[model samples]
Target: MEFVILTGLSGAGKTNALHAMEDSGYYCVDNLPPLLLETFYDLCDNSTDNRMKKVAVVADARSGEMFADIPEVISKLRLEGKQFKILFLDAKPNTLLVRFKGTRRKHPLIGEIASGSIEEAVELENELMNGVKAMADYVIDTTFMNPNELMERVTTLFSAGAHDTLLVTCVSFGYKYGLPPEADMVLDVRCLPNPFYIKELKPLTGLDEQVRNYICGFDVMGEFLDHLYAFIDYLISLYRNEGKSELVIGVGCTGGKHRSVTVARMLNTHLLENGQKSAIHHRDIWKA
Candidate 1:
């Protein structure tokens, strides 16, 4: 199992990093207490299922007094031969102050725990976390980074097979429901024949062999896919050269259940066949 502990300043975007890790297929837990670190690792380690192979937990100032135990726990794990990495996030004090002010959220060290201004709280937290920070395998200064950039950084550091390849996500959607906001490229498959009109195929999805056959039966379908595959192959090369870490391709038709799903699946297969890393998701498949 690959275990990762995420820690950092209160306003330094640790939550955003955790969300990014979750999106990258890691089983993530936020605000995990330091005392439970070994217990959590044991649970994940002894699991028969493979889903726990990658786990990330956030241990920050929110753990209060328990936060002090983090460094010791990390040392124990290391001594016991448990493999893990620490990711520490930090930002300039001014940037952290601005973030806290803009969000109007109280600093974790304020009130009864530590009586002072936000600046003092930030400084104190930094001092308390300095030990953990020194042990980090990766430290990200997020003062100038936006959420997207931070996510890319986190994914690049922790995602499997992400070192030398771009991650491609193919989304199947219905135009009527609106375009996916994150799409890098949108392909309209509405021009293809609609299987919803056919009484027999109406209830079936693109995954069904009959629906797949019907969609591929059209000459135009073959022609479109041929050109589409060639274009995407060229585009992927360009994107890789440009250092693009991720790409989202959207395929849309009247409804997401049929044509869009079929086309997205075809695109995903084509990408895999060409040695590209890709994932397919039918966004509106079960919508009424």
Candidate 2:
């Protein structure tokens, strides 16, 4: 079983990391006592009905006296051949202070912080947590990163693949509505003849063959697809070498009712057929 032990300085984004791990399919436990570490693992292993579970434990100084035993326990666990990794989340002292002040929580190291001072408390905690931080296999700075950025990093590090491919997030939007701010590539399908204009095909979307043929009927359409395919291949090569986790591609038409939706669906299928890990979103489809 793959196990991850998560510990970090207070206000350094441990909770956020836990949330992200949960999203990435880790069975997460929050604020677990250090002494219970082996007991928990034993319970998991000894259960007759217990299935193989990927486990993550969020541990910190809040375990009070039990926190002192973690290092020895970790050492013992390693000697016994446990499969585990430790990720320590940390941030700048100033950043942690701001986060604490904004939330207004008592520092984990109770008597250390100067009375009514965020800066003093931050420095004191950093000194105390240094030993724990030193033992981490990976340390992440979360000062400027949002949840999505953190999650992307975790997924990229954990994904079962020999090569890291560019993650393309393709969203189909409508010009009448608004463009998705997150798209890395945007293709305008407004110039493609509107299948909505046709009385017979009005009710159907680009998922329909007739609408797809109509959109691809123009000579420019063929050229567009040819260049688009090449561009995607080039991007995959560029990003995999650079260790990029995800990419976003947006396909927009006038209403997102017909042509753009069709193209986005087709592109999604084409990418899959070419052996890419990809997903698609029709942003404005329900609106129309």
Candidate 3:
């Protein structure tokens, strides 16, 4: 069993770190009380699912007073010969203040801060986390790291150990509706010949053989796909080099029912054939 106790001050990128851990094959539970550590471990160990064997959980100030005794719990886990590791995430107080302000989120410890200052709240949380931080097997200071950088750090520490692979999701959507808010990279396929203009193909979705055949019948499409596949293959390699566990690529067209869906599917199939981890979703395919 690989059990990790993730604790940190608020706004220290714990959420991103947990996502990376999840992508790296760790079963993640957020904001669990410290007192449940032993019980949770027992539950996971006794569970039949093999995936639960490698577990990482967040235990922190958000647990409030229940988090006060985490150091003792960690010590008990060690004494029992449980596979225990603690990762403490932190950031400069000023940086933490800036993060909270930018996100417009209230600090978990704001009530404890007499002056009601988020900066002071950071200081108080830092002071409170000292004992748990001292017990950390790894500590990440995210003051200078972006979300991707921070996730990369977490993946670096755990992904290899878990034999995890990078995950990629390709989404297809219509430009008329809106851009996908979650897309890490977006490509426009409006340059492709629109099947929507053809009477027979207009009624059919991109998944239909006739629509796909009509779109692929063009010389431009074949060339475009060749270039698109190569570009994405190269980019995926770069993302892997940076230790990113997942990447979201969006393909958009004038109407998602046709060109975008075909392109996204082609990209997804290309990735799989090239031995890359990938999945696809057509976001606006069914919409009128």
C-alpha lDDT of residue 36 in model 2 = 87
Clashing pairs in 1: none
Candidate 2 has its poorest 10 consecutive residues by lDDT at 156-165
CA RMSD, predictions in order: 11.5, 9.8, 10.4
lDDT of 2 by residue, 139-185 (tens): 66666456676566556444442133455656677888766655666
User: Scored by CA lDDT, what does every candidate get?
Assistant: 0.84, 0.73, 0.83
For residue 240, model 1's alpha carbon misses the true position, in angstroms, by 24
Question: Could you say which candidate leads in lDDT?
Answer: 1
Candidate 3 ranges with C-alpha deviation above 4 Å: 162-288
Per-candidate TM equals 0.56, 0.53, 0.56
Q: Compute the lDDT of residue 15 as modeled in candidate 1.
A: 86
TM-score of 1: 0.56
Q: Cα deviation in Å at residue 197, candidate 1?
A: 64
Q: Return the candidate ranking by lDDT, descending.
A: 1, 3, 2
Worst 10 residues of 3 by lDDT: 156-165
TM-score of 2: 0.53
The residue pairs in collision within model 3 are none
Q: What does the lDDT read for residue 277 in candidate 2?
A: 76
